[model samples]
Target: MRDRGLDVLLVTDPANIYYLSGYDAYSFYVPQILAVTHDRDQPVWIGREQDLTCARETTWLDREHVLLYSDDYVDSELHPMEFVVDRLDEWELADGTIGVELDADYYTARAHQAFTAALPTGAAVEDATKLVNYCRMVKSEAEIEYHQRAAAISERAMEVGIETIGPGVRKCDAAAAVHEALYSGADGTGGDYPAIVPLMPAGEGTGSPHLTWTDEEYEAGEPVILELAGVVNRYHSPLTRTMFLGEPPAEAERAAAVIIDGLEAALDAVEPGVTAESVERAWREEIAGTTVEKESRIGYSTGIGYPPSWVEGSVSIRPGDETELRPNMVFHMIPGVWFDDYGIEISESFRVTEDGAEVLADVPRELIVKE
Candidate 1:
């Protein structure tokens, strides 16, 4: 906080809150903040009275540090930030620049307006967007172990997805089996709910990236894209693969080969002291004259995800991102492309080693033909 000239930091992002305080719950639908300041050795946890037990059970803060407002503040005119501002004033920690997560998914505009308006004369609010997220770019040994376990779950879930999806099978049924496999986990490790649902776009719908499964039956000679993540203790290892129930079209096979080649080239480029965009450049160079072309970024930093996304919102692997690769940093390298009527997705979740990249999952890298 001192480095950024911030006297106080209001941590409102749930993932960031979890990162800081080890407080995890589904109570983020309402207003809450983990206040960090130079005045206190421990961060103060403030939230609704109903979630007091959640804070006490999940966080390491003392009883006095976990404060709660009355039930009237829940979805009423009272507003929780007003209570938060009052507490900050009472603690005498609000008399300087306060850092807030302005772009956080759960920090609403109304909350910000109330917070800023209620601040004391000497206090000011500044955008600290992604400040905590940047701190999470590199994984510790324990965090890396969780990601490795998650990758094992990912491999099992993907295997189930491939085996269950075929001609005459319902897409929803296949998705159910995949979900079961994900939750059941692998290597005796239980899984947590992933940030995203399974993305099983089929045939013509493959052109779109985020489509989920439908109840429709799978057809022969059609391609299906499975993009899923296995989670362990909120850490994710995402994997994507393309499959065909029958003999795939020649164009589809060719596109899949190009994607595989480019993905390998990108993974081979990962090492310490290299720029994020340089790895992407290697992929682009490998597929320069190929019919397959990709405009989106191929990978991003990922770990400790909450609902809606697994990306850490820090470093991105694409052109113009100058963040250098470092040992223990993890990334999900997904090289996917969508065409007019079909798409191909092949991905690997890897950690940057001192020498090169260490791929997390042990899965086949080609489009599976299941005839």
Candidate 2:
């Protein structure tokens, strides 16, 4: 953070706040901001009075530093200049460059406007979210442990999901089965977050990679695709699997074989020096001769928060992404292939190891045809 020429880093995005401070507030309808000095020690949380208990319990904030306003005090209504002046007075901050998250919503921008108004005679503001996120890309020991537990629950849920793929089961029913399995909690440890509701789709429904469970029914010998995640401890590990009610139809079987092979090819390419794009390229090369349509980028970095990464958004996902793969870096390689009317998705969570990548979940990638 010091290298970024920042005096303080302000985090207004709730997910980013949870990542840094461990304060998971349910009321995302309003805005919450975290102010941390460039030294990156002791983040001060400014939020609603209703969240005072949550701030005190979940965050490392000192009681005096956790500022709260009443429910009537809408953050958006705060004058940008007055809010900045107050924070400067409270923190005894001198003239220096303040930093904030660029992706932070309009409320954060309003805060920035207020700060600019105060200006403190000669101060600057810069976007520090990228720098903070770059630090978050690598997993800490505690973060990895949370993900491991989440992944284990997700694996158990996958087992139930696979079993529910037979003809009599509906997509909604399959999702419910997986949800119940994950909610049961693996190793008898309960979760802090809600159980995941999987999206179990079949046939044409599988064309949409992010499809949700509907009233679709699974027919014998039809391909069934499930995108499952277990949200635990405010973190999640999502995995995808495709199966057949009985034996996989010829087209589905072939697509699954190709997808499984591509996933292996991608995993084999993951190493400390490898770029995200290179890993994706490796997967694409494996499917070059296959008939299935393929997207360029294959996967993303993973973390404790649900959906720590995005497929299409401000998050970059290309080969030149200089973010080198490092040990303890978790990622999801969820590559699925669709051919004709058949689709199969095989995915797993992985943590980059000293030598290569280690699979976090034990769910098999093979086409499991339940009888």
Candidate 3:
């Protein structure tokens, strides 16, 4: 807090709260904040009264450090930030500049307005967006271990997804099998729910990457894209692959080759002291003459995610990004390309090592053709 000149930091991002206090629950659907003050050794955990037991059980916070507001503050005229303002007054933490995650997913405008308006006179509110996320860019050994376990589950789930998807199989049924494999985990390690649902875009929908599956059955000679992640203890390892039920189109095969080659080139470029954009440049150079062209960023930092996204919101691997690649930083190098009717996505989740990139999953890095 001193480094940023923040007297108190009001953290609302669930993943960041989990990182700081080990406080985990579905309670992020409502108002909750972790208060980091300059004087306190532990960050204060503030939430609804109903989740008090959840905070006690999940967090290492002392009883006094974990505070809860009355039920009247939820979804009513009385906002939870008003209670937060009262606590700040009681603790005398509102006398200086306060930092808030202004751009967090769950930090609503109403909450911001309430909190800022209720603060004491002369107390400044500054934007500390992604501050905690940047702190999480580099993973520790334990965190890396969790990511490796998640990668194992990802490989298993992807195998199930590919095997279950066929000409006559329903897309929902295939998604179910993939989910089972993800939750069941591999090598006796249990899995956690991923930040994103299975993205199974098939046939013409393959051109759009973010489309989810429906009850529709698979058709012959069509491409299906499976984008999924395996989460272990909230850490995520995302994986994407393209499959064909029968004989695949020649264009798709060619694109797959280009993507795989470019992905390898990008992975090979990962090392300490290298800029993130350097890796992207390698991929672009490898596919310069190919018909497949990608405009979106290929990959991003991944770990310790919550609902809606697995990206860590730091260090994107793309052109013009100058973030330095440090050892132990993990990234999902996904170089996917889409055409008018079909798309190909073959990705790898890797960790930057002192030597080079350490690919996490053991899945075959190629297009899978099933007859």
Candidate 4:
């Protein structure tokens, strides 16, 4: 952004494109750079003609520069370096320091190197994606509306998944059930991430969190862990719930209670001015003596895309994340527990509000039992 002291920002990441412009098509074959400045007149875009149509329809780009490439471009036969140079020369952008995202894809890096080499003497290539990501941390009004609808679809799919969990149901079948439910309820687009795929580890598979679905039959008293999400218009809501095919063992029941308690504790910590570290600590405090092993962060910000709210710039969840919990910020809390052959888990979506936070999904968090 121009306010961040950069004259122009070159965005190569797909998610970044979706964040800035509402362009979410899969056109990686064609290179794209979004030039942004505080002055609307100076803002521009560089991409292929097909992509330009989508950008023009949903976005507010001041100008767009299209490039034509041959089949050799894909196989590394022809490079697009010269094409960008002529455009820069025509735009008279040979003076200001140019900033490119550090995390550009390999193809984007090649194009960036070409641009730098071809530019006039004074132009400099700098990294400015951190600033762009910081801007994306906070959700806009339209972004929140997309996420709310996604969460609603995810909740309905989850409910359908819970109800379909009887004997003789294959893990993949259950995952399929969830997919169908969400797709029917949604506006006909795959979510930001894979939706309705139950990583159900039944019987011995329950011990590993990374286990995928199989044709394994549901047995009496066997714990079935269902991890799934529903994709609604390219947005996602992740959730995981465990239930008994018949009646779970007493030990599993106790673990479920502990996991639910931990989940609630983490959810309670999600208020304005709260730190990511503090949120994770709340879950640990609840499961202090429990046998479960915690792995990832307790939760993350959610918007149009899953994992869209990354800590942005740093790995440690420390103060540099001055990501103040502004109202309208959305988050997905996945507080889980790993206990021997069975895992206990709970998940939900929430939006930060003035008073506190609003729960977007109405799905019940109680231990779901399918008879």
Candidate 5:
């Protein structure tokens, strides 16, 4: 806070709240904040009275710091911000510069207004939305283990997905088998719900990246793409693989090879001194004159997340992103290609090591073709 001249900091992003205070709950839909000050060593977690028990169980904070407002404050004419502001005033922080998350899930407009109105003095609120995210860019050893476990779960799920999907089978049924394997995880350790459900888009629908599954039976000669993650301790190891039921068209095979080659080229460029865009350029150069092409970014940072999406919103591996590669940082390198008729996605979740990127999954990086 001193480095940024922030007298107080209010974190409203649930992922960030969990990052700072380890306060995880299904209550991120409501207004919550983890307050920090330079004067104190520990942060304060603020949430609804109903969730205080959850906070006590999950957070490392002292019982006193796990604060709560009355249940009467839940979605009423008076917002939870009123009580938060009152607490700030009582704590003598109303006159100080408070940093608030502007683009956060819980930092709604009403919450912003309440905080702004409560600070009568020149006490200002600044945008610190990406602050905690940037801090969490690199992973700790323990976090890597979590992601590795997640990757193990993902590998088994992919196996199930591959085995269960075929001609005459319902798409949803195949998705179910994959889901079962995803949640079942590896032996001895159980997996948590992923930030995203299995994204299994098949045939012509593959052009749409986010499509799930259907009740329709799989047709011969069609391709299916599976994009999903295995989550453990909120850290994710996402993977994607495409499969063809029968003999894949010559064009499909060629496109998959080009993508794999481009991805390898991109991976080769990932080292401590390289820039994010420079890595992208390696892939772009690899597919420069090829029939296949990809316009979207090929990769992005990934780790600890909540629902709606698992994208690490902090940094992206794309053109114009000048961020340098750092050790212990993790990413989902997706060279997802969408054609007019269908799409192909073969991705890997990996960690940046001192030498290069270490892919988490042991699965073969190619289009899996089976008769």
Candidate 6:
């Protein structure tokens, strides 16, 4: 807040709200805001009146700091910003220059307009979405531990996918196995829901990055791309790999090699003080002579997230992004390449240390093939 010249900050992003105050409930489909001021040690968690019970049970905040607007305010023309304005007045922060997350997923245009108009006349609303995300870039020791746990779950989940997926196997059955492994956690440690569902873009659809599965049966000689995350306490370690039901073509095998090499190159460039784009540039340079090429970003920051997505959205490992790396920063580097017929993706979630990057898992890097 001080760096952004914000006397008070109004955070509407559910991820940020959970990060700041531990207010965990899927209550963000409606409007919610976490208020932070220079004067208070604990930020106030505000949301729909019905969600207050969840906030009380989940958050670390005292009930006095958990404010709620009436349920009547929702699903009506009435905006919850009016109650936020009331709280600002009650807390004596009504006239302060407040920073709001204008770019956040939950902070809609209507909400922004409604809240901005209700603030006191002298007060200002500034775009500070990046501010919180930037602060969240570097992981603490505890956060890294959670990530390691999530990584463990991710490895087991990948194994389940590989075991259950084959020619004539129903894609839904494979997806079900994956979900079991994901939420079952590892070593008796229970897991949480990942920000994204199992993305198993298969056969001709392998080239598409975000396609979900259907009831179609797997076919021989077809490639299946598995992009999944293992979540622990909301921390994610997303992992991806390609599997083939039969002997993959020589070209497909070569593309997998290129993907792995490029990903390693990017990971090697992820030490402290390096630029984000430099990582992508390294991957591109590594694959220059190869037939594989990708125009999309290879990676982004990851950790501490909610439904809708797990990408922290602060930084990206791609061209034109100049965000510098620092120790304890985590990233999921995916040097995936897509051809007209298929795609090959092998990714790693690593942490930036002072010396080098620490790859989070020991999973096999090559495309798995089964006859």
Q: Report the Cα RMSD per candidate.
A: 1.1, 3.3, 0.9, 4.0, 1.4, 1.3
Candidate 2, residues 195-273, lDDT tens digits: the string is 2346676767676665677766777767678776666666667788877767767776777788888889989988888
TM-score of each: 0.98, 0.86, 0.98, 0.80, 0.96, 0.97
Clashes per prediction? 0, 3, 0, 0, 0, 0
Model 3 agreement with the true structure over 296-330: per-residue lDDT tens digits:
99999999999889989989999999999999999
Alpha-carbon shift of residue 342 in model 6 (angstroms): 1.5
Per-residue lDDT value at 351 in model 1: 98
lDDT for each residue of candidate 4 in 78-105, tens digit (9 for 90 to 100): 4555555565566566566667777745
Output the number of the TM-score-best candidate: 3
For all candidates in order, the CA lDDT equals 0.92, 0.71, 0.92, 0.64, 0.87, 0.88
The segments of candidate 6 whose C-alpha lies over 4 angstroms from its true place after superposition are none
Clashing pairs in 5: none
Tens-digit lDDT track for model 1 on 224-306? 99999999989999999999889999999999999999999999999999999999999999999989999999999999888
By TM-score, the candidates rank as: 3, 1, 6, 5, 2, 4
Higher-TM-score candidate of 2 and 4: 2
Please write out the lDDT profile of model 6 over residues 219-289, one tens digit for every residue.
99899999999998789999998998899999998888888888888887778999999999999999998
| Comparing 1 and 4 on TM-score, the stronger one | 1
Q: Candidate 3 clashing pairs? A: none
Q: Can you tell me which runs of candidate 3 are displaced by over 4 Å?
A: none
For model 4, name the residue pairs that clash: none
Record all residue pairs in model 2 with backbone atoms less than 3 Å apart, i.e. clashing.
80-114, 81-114, 277-319
**Candidate with more favorable, higher lDDT: 2 or 3:** 3
Candidate 2 accuracy as lDDT: 0.71
lDDT of 6 at 305: 82
lDDT of 5 by residue, 126-152 (tens): 788888888898889999899899999
